[model samples]
Target chain A: MRTEAGPPVTVVVGAGLVGASIGHALTGAGWRVHLVDAVPSHAMVAAGLGAGTAEPAEPSEVGLVVVAVPPRTIADVVGESLQTYPYATVTDVGSVKAGVLDALWERPVDLTRYVGSHPMAGSHHSGPVTADGDLFVDRTWVVTPHRKSAEASTARVVELVRACRARLVTLDVDDHDAAVARVSHLPHLVSVLMAGHLTDVPEEDLVLAGQGLRDVTRIAGGDPGLWQQIVRANATAVLRELRQVAVSLDRLITAVETAPTDEAPADLSLSRELERGVDGTRRIPGKHGSAAVPYEQVVVAIPDEPGALARLFGDVEAAGVNVEDIAIEHDASRQVGYLTLSVQPERAEGLAVVMRDGGWTVV
Target chain B: MRTEAGPPVTVVVGAGLVGASIGHALTGAGWRVHLVDAVPSHAMVAAGLGAGTAEPAEPSEVGLVVVAVPPRTIADVVGESLQTYPYATVTDVGSVKAGVLDALWERPVDLTRYVGSHPMAGSHHSGPVTADGDLFVDRTWVVTPHRKSAEASTARVVELVRACRARLVTLDVDDHDAAVARVSHLPHLVSVLMAGHLTDVPEEDLVLAGQGLRDVTRIAGGDPGLWQQIVRANATAVLRELRQVAVSLDRLITAVETAPTDEAPADLSLSRELERGVDGTRRIPGKHGSAAVPYEQVVVAIPDEPGALARLFGDVEAAGVNVEDIAIEHDASRQVGYLTLSVQPERAEGLAVVMRDGGWTVV
Candidate 1:
């Protein structure tokens, strides 16, 4: 630990994934971190599991307090924290920024010691057990500083992101919400709706589902409580994006309805439309944080059964290749399926050779 | 392998995933199967890849021809095959039945030997590579027998499905398209549109994506050619479902845009409207084709590195527990993260033990 200054005292509220994570990262950065959760024993539950521990918080002793509770409860928590810890600078890591801003509007606090921040990052998993110290590395952390926010406070938050090795994105509260609504919130809702379809399916039929269904409906399994709060909090912007999606869907429906008969020479138009939709959608990066450079895929063939996937990944790791994305295709009839791994373009050739040498089939 | 009597020969045309799977299954069922594909190499590829293959075709030598090809091309391929091999009973595995029916509208053929079929099973993958003998096992195989269709032909097709271990779903051409449009086509289009949004994202942000983004956008990587054909062939039904989804989306937008502020609690009416949409959508089945069963989750803490997930899964598997779903929550600020796995009600306790015994932190 850096002794130049007895570690910077950092405080995190909530023992959820976000809060625990912030605490872990700060501790790794030589910061003396204290965690606080609304539930009295929450911090202890987390700390005993090796995630980290929260020290009994005192208002004046902590230099910074981060509120990482659910969106619906963020404002109340932030406000209480600000009032309770008068000397500490306050910040929040909420999904929606404008909601927090609006909630804090009436509660006049020392604005100079507060800044609004959101990291455009998360896993589908949640809570303290999943918190990691390096989760923010190379991720985007948005800093929404109000005009009333003190420059020192803003810098402190920026420094917090830097300490975690995360990139900084600055935007106003509304813009941040809108952008997230487009990138994250809308996607969540769409996935939920899609997965909800499976809710009524006959149990036997779902067994036939392939990787596509698995991938498309993955987010549907998210924490309903957390999602309820997120969607409700960012309802306006999320719905706006939903409407945009609705427009495209409507157009697609219209085209499908009026499509020519299969015998007609020009009947390929609908196919073209569907193709357009697909082409438009592949712009998403699979695993790499950098969307600009798409990861290169190398498909590996493996047999179906236990330990097959585990061993394949083990080989990838053994070869010192980082797999950015992985897709598995398995059908028992063939007894063999292919696994597509997206690796850095520069590493693909080397990774393929190493994997093949490890007694795996690379396609 | 059953030597009591040789099963009737089955010839499957087109040799795609569905067609090949049917052939593979039939061959496995003691049937002398003959598979054909226009692209002369298709049979070889399909068989070599373990999807299916043909034992040299003699004119009218097989009992049935299962045409499994793209919707736009199915009609032409089936028509030609029907003419070329007049004695073979024939059926097709196309998504859009209406288009194929319309294509054969006035064609004079042995209707007694032909029954239209659509197996409501597929993968995001395409072609012979993804074909498997078990693809149709326990899945629904819709058989649309025409008015003039021979009872014997329908029986043969039904027998074909039975051999594949798939359940029978009887429906006419139009109804099948409409139902599938609702369940499959519309959802796929939605996935594409959402994934397409990230195409323009800068390279920097792409690398930061986690399992959530991957899950939501996975289907976006599907082959455009196959999807285009599907959307075009089943345009009418797809369009209908898209309209229904649009209505739901519109209502959601209205509710959110008009949401009450702090002065008034969010309008319960709007929330109800959104809930209705959610309820209607959730009627879809969950995993294993079962009815949508709402589950409560327990997240487990796990380390952030290689073999963590593997060890976790190995323990869960060793406990003889089936996992409904698995999700990983990664926090950028923390180096640790949690993995949330969905399991059946009866298996949750057992799974917790498996994790605990495996030295994992299950919360």
Candidate 2:
């Protein structure tokens, strides 16, 4: 049996994007990471990228086991991990938790040592080639502990979240699934439905597309096979959320159909639904899970040339105000780019003046 | 009567975001602009910002008139403009083109001098304060010429689009409405519906929200009053798109309901729908009305201190490769920012090396 007094060591099963990223981070933190995968090449590739060692020179000293396989294979792989490392805390990084736990009940594995984890850092791109130690930085990592999950096992998983520099949120196994269905799975399917319709749109008419369409459809470009597995594992919750959206969509259709011709007042119901959306969107937390703050943007028209940004940044630094955030907008057709600096509202006026004095066009 | 021999002159009505922006651009181009608004203060404020002169010293010899009022009031304002400025080409920058033409048929205004122009630079922020001369730069500006519209008036509208540095796409008036429904209006309602569900979600569960949910719902935060007017103008086409999505959604619900446990392989139709989304997302044009080109991102961890970006951009500029685009990501929770620079595929490796050698963390 492993003890907390021993050197930290972990066995990471399945060297995919999530697994490899965890391996990379644990290795960097001086943990002995044993990277294993069904595909030997994937394990080798991940190890070559300095994620961990593929060779298991010793096994009895393993302190924790992390299962990072696909959703459908998570139950089997996690079961194997618990049996292989009997004394180690076991956890599976599956997007869906209840499905894995329910499947595990039929197997002869120790439920007390197993917990469920889902790192809310999803990317369309997959594989070990895209893995990074910083992927989970400031991200919310949910740890789901069922009724049988031991407090010791949950605490060990919390250690992993801290090591990854992620914020921790403990939830029930089933509650975790429901939250993801409302936030992630449902949004993914809606994005897919929107993009799928684009398949029938004429290429020329698509010239009218804007940033809104681009953003709304971006997630639809994710891997279909992987998403299929994810949604299947959490089918019930996803269906509930999807049906709710469908009801609202039907109401929108009716509103659009009944609206009188232009120049006449319409029913207030459509406006109310739209206002609800406005409120909901405002409820989302700001980037990095920070509370949302009101920011005013100071727009700068930057010339596309060598050291233009350098000059701009130097001038901004001279103003002694930190730019809270920035968005750089460029189009191939234009030589000038619009770089919007989001700063505290109180500082916007002074920053604009400072920028304008620097001979930079502050739009 | 105005002639081509006279100096460039135009009367801008509405003095809102679109109108003020047009006035701003035209004034910068050395044209004499007379800005007017239903609310006298709007024109006064817009003129104060150098959009144009609110006081019209002379009314004769006006070469063109741009009507940029609310969508519901466009036809009335535009008809009045044509009657007020005889022999001048008249155009309205409305989101829905066919509605305006449809409403105009009931009036006695000459159709020869009128054309429909929709500057596809819609922003959630409105009014003159949010207006800029560069708002229309490289944006798609659609000009809709009806069957009876004279070629000279269409040419004048085309020139206005060019003066604002926007790309021109001329289509039939009714076709313009259909295209916006599919590309703009429908996506908007989908975004709204998706966000509307967030109202019922527990605030704690919303912490699970990622960039995908935020992106998909960002447009939902737009002013409900403005969107109500827009969707109403293009109701028929918006209704058609929404019904089509509804049909696809019903199929999705059935697939979700019948799916078996996680370990089993399910139907292929769900996967096909997701794959179609992947294909459709790939079909959207790249930024700046350009064809989509494959670019690789060189991720740089920028410190949240002054002169950090200056040094980074300095190193990047020294590499002698221009960054095709840049996305600046900063979270208030972290002291470090991830600045992803999108460059041509061939230049990424060299740029990364340059950044790393300069002591910047290239992730």
Candidate 3:
């Protein structure tokens, strides 16, 4: 990490969630931050929220200029920021980097001072009101340095990531787009397609929906205008994955249609695809980039009253067992909830016994 | 609703999750449930768990016979059960009703004695070990009686659902298959297709997975064999939905690829699909078959120590605000978690004020 005598002065362009959040984190870190936005009220709102001071950029004194504009306007804004703040290293926080870099390449702009970065953190809500100072903490922030980028510029971007307390991952622009296409863009569209089916469904049928349907379609509730831009920005990569899904879906349809008869031998193709699904799920990293570990879950019945959860947690804490994770499931009709606690496999039985003995219902 | 002086004795076949859960609920409701399975060990395990007694069915005295076998064997098993217990009403709790009914249509069995029912309740786990008596509570149980079925058989099935505290929805066999095909089968395949794309993904890319991908692909982690059976059993209905999805995916690809240029007008199709997704998600019942009410979420930063969550909940309770729901998000690297409490919209500000005044960080 680069050590400085005082907090670095940084200039933030755009007062959206990403930009505001970056300002909030840097301000809380003792940085002198200036926020500028085309929409004056947005900048004022972000400033009021303690993100930064709503003011023009101090071009000469600024050490870093961060552009957190939408994908379509990123290149133009980055070009202007670089020209205005000639002494400062400039970077952008756009979802797609390769397209922006290509757009910049078309302009007569200096590329050596620019590094493209994307903090892989977001919420369903948009704008600065949903901004949190700790949004990027412990989240991966991808830094994509073009071939023309200077070593010093790359170093400055890394320092900025460190100041925001985010894990740094280095990738080329193309590689970054492809990775997000698989992990983010593809899943997003899949959610949309699944949820779109519900558009014409009868209300009576939808009443039977369960947790499985809910989980699959939760992300479909995001803003369409923003997502359209994202999908369009990375169209090539996303289209590639979408075609792969189409082919897989076709094969599954065939497999289901030609499933084995009672007297015939079983077909391995269907099982093969499902096993592949299992394999893919296993590859997702759990907390802290670790393999997904299996935890024994102990479900405790708790009333819907406010103090019930507190009492249950107190009882669990008294047992000296650590709770790894928790999920609260409510039975709407009964107004009762099941608090599922995940703990070390060996400790589950002990924890359940303790909770049950303490007058709690453990299932 | 039908009323009886005492809880009716019900015999459950196939001691799996659904079967054993039914047994557990019925037994808890004062029913004498006999548990049987081709696999003797499964029945014995269900018996040990107090789901029911491991014994042969007393056909002459049985009031109801529930066939909870896999979809492929449901018809055959239901036929044998109806023949064995001539006086008892027979029902099979299979995921797909039409396929089972069609199979029975080809047999010489008495269709008037059978009722095809499906309880839309399941978990990722299978078998009796993961069974819970409360699984069916607040869940929808569909009863699709055949055209040749008598009213008495349907009434018995309705009483069974009432004993398990499940909501009842009656639909024709074809309608039930189509409804589940749209809601359950389509989502499952979509999850499978998305997850299959991850089969060959680089581990580095998979590490960037977030809650969005986790939620979208969660159902993909289920048993492949069981899912294959489910998809195949409802092939016609599932294939129809799958084909519709294929057309939708194609349109989405075209929309993304041909997105509006800077000088061109914005495309309406992409935005339309996304808007439809939003509308669909809005229609899902929030709790207790009520409209999806939006709750205000307040996030609190808590230490990872033993009593930190308990203390936070206690503080919230002391403020006298009811927590509608809670989601605990842990930043594993930092060992800190954000406990997000959802409350009534009108009470959020007051709750935040109280908690902040009590030395808690509320965001």
Candidate 4:
């Protein structure tokens, strides 16, 4: 392996949201980036958005080539990128790593030059228009390199992750697939299945939806074509999780069906399932990848004006409290919105007092 | 039926979040309000928070008695309230209207004075301390009065809904149950089941969760005890939906299992299911009860400082654009946040320009 001087030159193929975002991040990090896409306009659009120049990389000149394509095409694209740029270490940012690696294994491609990676970051919106340079910041980027993969190739991908400011998690192909199936793919399908029931619901009934329904179905709004491919590519792992979920659903159904009509006794099985849900939720990592810490939420009523939130944050800062997270609750017809601020438990009381003293209603 | 005069006196039983909120709203609307709870301290706290006076209503003096109890006890509370306040109309705000009404039918209580109502409003936080006077403003209040309910009783409940500034949707008991089963109960279970899967997830994998998982599992964090009662009360309807979902999952699992290894063709059933999900998501009512309208989202980068949101909103107001909705996205370790502003499609470009010109990053 030869060491290159100055900023690394990286090429990003497939100019969709992830690809364009990678290009944008790499360009911002002083890496010379070249972008390509099957649809030439997508590459041009991504380039125009300052992601990179819409030019193919010269042979042996590129240090790394990142293939960000649909799951079905990942292996093909990664193989082509590897063969096309002999000197560059190749990586693909596809959701399903095992299938792609297996597909490549079946081919005559050089496995030593390639690594499979997936950045666990995305937006509801797609396309280059929604591509953001800082999209990968603080996100986990999982790299799955097989036994045949060269150490130099894996190091090159790690360099790419560093340039994008994403945390790195090294997992084998099967583990990456299983982890994503449990965390991402399974949840996506669950959201889709839940939202699917809404198709025939009356408009009047749907008008009664609250934040809970919104949260449950929000990801169901993703492009169907993209999700179909993802689900198909990770079919084995996703099927395993789906089967587990189906069994759980059946158990819950039976628990509900056999529940006493007239409150004979507490439904132990039903309560146990709900308790398990609480346990599951508690397992989700809080900010900074720490164990999920229950934060004290302080609800403040803000006038529906432009500067109200800004002013509230100002007051929160003045009170020496850090706002960990916030959610805004507003109705179209209401002139006031409630801003729920999640903060450290110890800081909540003081912040509430400060806000209340500053003439804000804190509940 | 006797008509009452001069700002109708209302009594709210069960001083939890919903009941206290109703009390607060009614008191603010010029009603003589009284609050009661099985737990005396809960009523006292709600009263001290200015929701209402912690006193029982005099016989024949209360114009309306609102029973906001657990679903299992709703019928009993509503029946007792109706008997105690002989001249007053009574309503219960249990989630499952049909179950409560059926429980009432099994009793000797008069049905003419009682109405089954549910306000489709809530927050993740529970209890009286989290109550707010405007909680029901712009929310749908479903009144599921049976055939035996008197016109006067239904009208009185409508008046209460009006006083709270909530939109009213009148449905028969069975229809209300079915509608909620499709929209609310089923989604809640899906969220719970999805969250339940996370119980055994490794912390390293849990850190990979994104917004999709967050949204899907958010409501799973609700009080399990409360949810257990709710699920049990609506078991019949919820079970029906659960069975349908289980079938869908089974079908999806089969489709994935039988999928072509070499991507010969897309799994027709899998694609169709996902397409149905897209259709379903589009059917959800948007702001102001309109059909879901796709809004153009403009991303604005805000400095991680106090008043950043306020300044952004101020600039947005200065641009004379009404933000349809806004979401704040920030990483725990990041010093900047992305505020995704949803606006009228035509207004998005102009707002982006205005934001960019105002020294904000618009993507």
lDDT to native, each model: 0.67, 0.83, 0.83, 0.81
Model 3 has a clash total of 0
Please report, as a residue range, the 10-residue window in candidate 1 chain A with the lowest summed lDDT: A284-293
Instruction: Pull out the clashing pairs in model 3.
Output: none
10 residues in a row with least lDDT, candidate 3 chain A: A122-131
Candidate 4 stretches with Cα past 4 Å from truth are A1-9, A44-50, A127-132, A261-264, A303-308, A311-320, A331-336, A357-361, B1-4, B127-130, B261-264, B302-307, B314-318, B331-336
Ranking by DockQ: 2, 3, 4, 1
DockQ of 3: 0.60
Better of 2 and 4 by TM-score: 2
DockQ of 2: 0.63
Model 2 agreement with the true structure over A1-363: per-residue lDDT tens digits? 566673358989989889999998888878889899999888999999999999973556787889999887999888888888868888988899998999989788899999999987635433213678877777678899888989988988998998988878889887899999998899999999999999999888788787678878978988898899999899988988998888988887887777664665666778888898888898787765677777887888888776788778888888988787776766435557778787888999999999989998776
Candidate 2, residue B146: lDDT: 92
Give per-residue lDDT, candidate 2, residue B246: 97
- What lDDT score is found at residue A339 in candidate 4? 80
Cα-based RMSD of candidate 4: 2.9
- The DockQ value obtained for model 4 is 0.59
Q: Per-residue lDDT of A38-89 in model 1, one digit per residue for the tens? A: 8858787666645456567656777788888888888888888888887677
Cα lDDT tens digits, model 4, B229-279, are 887888788887888888888877876787764575756788888888878
Query: What is the DockQ for all candidates, taken in turn?
Result: 0.27, 0.63, 0.60, 0.59
State residue A353's C-alpha deviation in candidate 3, in Å: 2.3
User: lDDT per residue, candidate 4, A1-363, as tens digits?
Assistant: 336686667888899889999989989988899999999999999999999999777767888888988777888888888788878889999888888888888787788999889887774545325788888886778888898999988988998989899888899999888888898899999998988878767776676676678779988878888888888888888988998898898888887887664576867888888888878888877656666788888888887665566567667777877677788765434456678887888888888889999999776
User: Candidate 3, after superposition: displacement of residue A327 in Å?
Assistant: 2.4
Q: In model 4 chain B, which range of ten residues has the least summed lDDT?
A: B121-130
